[model samples]
Target: MNPCDTMLADDEAVIRALLNEVPFNGWTRTALRRALAACNRDPDDAAFLFPGGAADMIETWACLADRDMEAAALAADLAAYRTPARVRAIISLRFEQNRPHRDAIRRAIAVLALPQNAKRAATITARTVDSIWHAAGDRSADFAWYTKRALLGGVYTSTLLFWLRDTSDTDEDTIAFLDRRLNNVATIGKTRKAITDKRPKLRIPMPGFMRTWAERA
Candidate 1:
């Protein structure tokens, strides 16, 4: 199969194989990371890494996201159906960080137990979602879990992505965003309980043109 067109499952296996073959480090590792980043928006830019002249790995990565999300959600082994929003958040965060450890997943989710060193990021908060998965081992990672989990992942990635793109100091806007989202999620279920099933209409603050632009984006 063309390396470029390989799906994430295939890519994961290849990466695993490469790691086993040699020390997967140095310039080669960095190159692979950059290639993965560019593969989605600009596949041909990293086509040199692949055997065939034309193959798109990014599409397969997205396919992997879909593939794995569906697989895990449907599987009995996983605790519950992880929401699509959570999956997107995980993918987005993973892309932003370039690498993440599995332990980090535990902190964002309470039910899922994690190793002690897993989420030891310096000054990291509980809301920085580490995985796009439901809590396993003993109970269900239901709607409440999924919603909270999605909020955590979405807030962090959105904050960081914009922070990286932003040319400002202190990342004040990003922090503010985190605070606002945290407060919203924190109260949503509580408020919903009091209201007893009152549906919340998500408001779009942007003007008509901006709304359209965001959707297209």
Candidate 2:
């Protein structure tokens, strides 16, 4: 992947620079304008920079997190780990890297979780998991591609929520929670594969009535 492709634009960097001010000003267009003032940028540029207002800021923040996660993964030595371990490592790196920005992240999550931003939120979650998979050296091009990312999405989101609320001083509790979620996903995948492999494939269709009754059973 070209690192430049994920590089933040000047406007995005400006928005990120204002995260510390988010709690004070909130993630509004007004907040952005005020932030621009502090940065010696034109407040009128806010519209040009984030036409979607807070939604844009939140979405950009998510994208930035994904890019940072990928960069960290690239710098780390994860070659020795298996696929599951590597996935967990990449996700853990993301949370750890953003630890200092937890408040900003929490506020971003609130903005993304709004009813109007549901689709963007889902897109951001999907993209983050996709980046993690790529960084973990996954080369799947078939059904596993979707399944793996989908599973990780669930794991990562749950673990992030846990981390945000976790009171553990060293964050060991959050790490354990993340590990359990990943382990559960692995177990479920193995169990599903075993079940699928053991089930006989039927070339002939059963009678419609019988199939309907079987489905109810």
lDDT of 1 by residue, 1-217 (tens): 4222454454654333322222233224344444455334333334445332111222222233334444453453433424434444333444333223122222222212235424432113232242244322213343345445546655654555455544444445555565576566668768856554543444424457645644554
Name the best candidate (by TM-score).
2
Model 2, residue 193: distance off in Å is: 0.9
Residue pairs in collision within model 2: none
Candidate 1: where are CA atoms >4 Å away?
1-56, 59-96, 99-139, 149-161, 168-173, 196-217
lDDT of 2: 0.79
lDDT of 2 by residue, 1-217 (tens): 2222544577566766778678777888777888788788898888776667787777777777787899999899899999888887888898788877778888888988889999888888888888899999988765556667778889989999999997776678888998889889989899868765766673545457646655554
Q: On a 0 to 100 scale, what is the lDDT of residue 179 in model 1?
A: 59
Residue 27 of model 1, lDDT score? 21
Residue 38 local lDDT, model 1 = 38
Lowest summed lDDT over 10 consecutive residues: which window, candidate 1?
A: 104-113
